[model samples]
Target: MAKAKPNNKVDPNKYLKNKDIEPEGKLGVAAAVGRMGLMLVGIVGIATEFFRDDGWLKAALGKLFESTSSMMLIPVIIFVLWLLNRWMSSESKSETKKSGDIPMYAMMAVGAYYLFKLITTGSL
Candidate 1:
């Protein structure tokens, strides 16, 4: 009688090669979504500045500032980013961060561009 072949196939372990690696599941999806949101907000801010005026962006930001204390905004953003980074890289065996952190980098770039636009327009 012929022996039946074992059928369960396992994916190659990514952690084996890279000691510190980011996963490609819900964590990646969440990070991508966050980055996309930030990018969209930046695009809208710039569009408002060009199409309408800086008042819309300023009003939107003003409302945000009014609701939350100015001191907490920067700290909260930093904490959130740090938390996400830690959570995403928690599976890695080493302390070193892996490359290909695209979403995070893109989000940061968008934030910088948005701030530059606001500053240049004297909106902030």
Candidate 2:
């Protein structure tokens, strides 16, 4: 009796149909950029405080929050970024694009407001 050869090849159509597989390249790059930006911000802020002559602890805390509005804005920025990332990483093809894209636009509006405020008042 002859031995049957085992199937070693995966069907491309079936592989593509599997929703569990995430598309590569751009997804990883976006995550890397976000992480690097956060690290760079932290490093700059820490270096600034370390090089200053004033009381580091109090000044660092004060500069971190700045004010109630600034403190609130921090979480909102984080949430918006996370939401956008999740939406981008979703593998669902049937999802309607228009239903969940509002956060980015809303963030843009908030960003514009902050930029205008900074320009006019010289402070955020």
Candidate 3:
């Protein structure tokens, strides 16, 4: 007839002292979602403009912008997700690994492309 006693000496704060398990960096989801929402708003604006207009060419071009704007957001969204993944991963190799910074540049490139198109087309 032997009785076993439970160990009550485990300290929860001991885990907190370990830096390797701690989380770091920002999650890019909120930013990505916000950007997508802005792009959607831009698309809706373009669509409304098209429906309100009488010229076929102008309407078609407006719709192109509507669709393209959303398409352009796709890469940006992927980039954001990649960043969040890089931030949240705990593996040491993952910590040292870097995500492509090209998405930021891609956003700039898209902005420039749209600006150039708008200027050359004189559609604004």
Candidate 4:
């Protein structure tokens, strides 16, 4: 019987315990989880708002986004766009590509528009 040699190379994440390979810090994990959780909550809230047909701008947004007033949408669209810009810029590539942030950003923009409307116009 012949014995086989073990492979020497391995994935650094799986093989190494060095400081550089480690996470920035424990708080990073907490912050990331918190951000993702908050995003999820926003998504679910809007999704719930959709099928109910009375939660506000859910249908209007999910549809072609036929808002009754453009004046009402202007500031909100601007603000949400700004927020999305900041959010997307700060995020890492893995997050932007794989973390589902784009769709989330889109949903957040819609939700934010309605939220802004809800706050300012007292309607959505």
Q: lDDT: which candidate is best?
A: 1
Q: What C-alpha lDDT does candidate 3 achieve relative to the native structure?
A: 0.59
Runs of candidate 3 exceeding 4 Å displacement: 1-27, 53-124
Q: State which candidate, 1 or 3, has the greater TM-score.
A: 1
Which run of 10 residues does model 3 get worst, by summed lDDT? 96-105
Model 2: worst 10 consecutive residues (lDDT sum): 38-47
The sequence of per-residue lDDT tens digits that candidate 4 reaches over residues 1-93 is: 999999898776864556567546889988767566656656765666766756556645644345556457878988998886775564565
lDDT to native, each model: 0.69, 0.64, 0.59, 0.64
TM-score, cand. 1 vs. native:
0.29
TM-score of 3: 0.26
Identify the leading candidate in terms of TM-score: 4
Q: Residue 109 lDDT in model 1? A: 80
- Judged by lDDT against the true structure, how good is candidate 4? 0.64
C-alpha RMSD values across all candidates:
16.0, 11.7, 12.2, 10.2
**Residue-level lDDT tens digits of model 3 in 32-64:** 665665455455444545566575558655665
TM-score of each: 0.29, 0.30, 0.26, 0.36
Best-to-worst ranking by TM-score: 4, 2, 1, 3
lDDT of 1 at 62: 70
Candidate 3: lDDT of 107?
Answer: 51
Encode model 1's per-residue lDDT on 1-124: one tens digit a residue: 9999998888679457786776689988998877776677666665766456546667766766886577478788889998877756746576545443655576568666877767789662
Shift in Å, residue 105, candidate 3: 9.7
**Tens digit of per-residue lDDT, candidate 2, span 1-124:** 9999998998778756677876769979997665555445445444555567675767766776888766777778889988877776546867656646565455445555555655689754
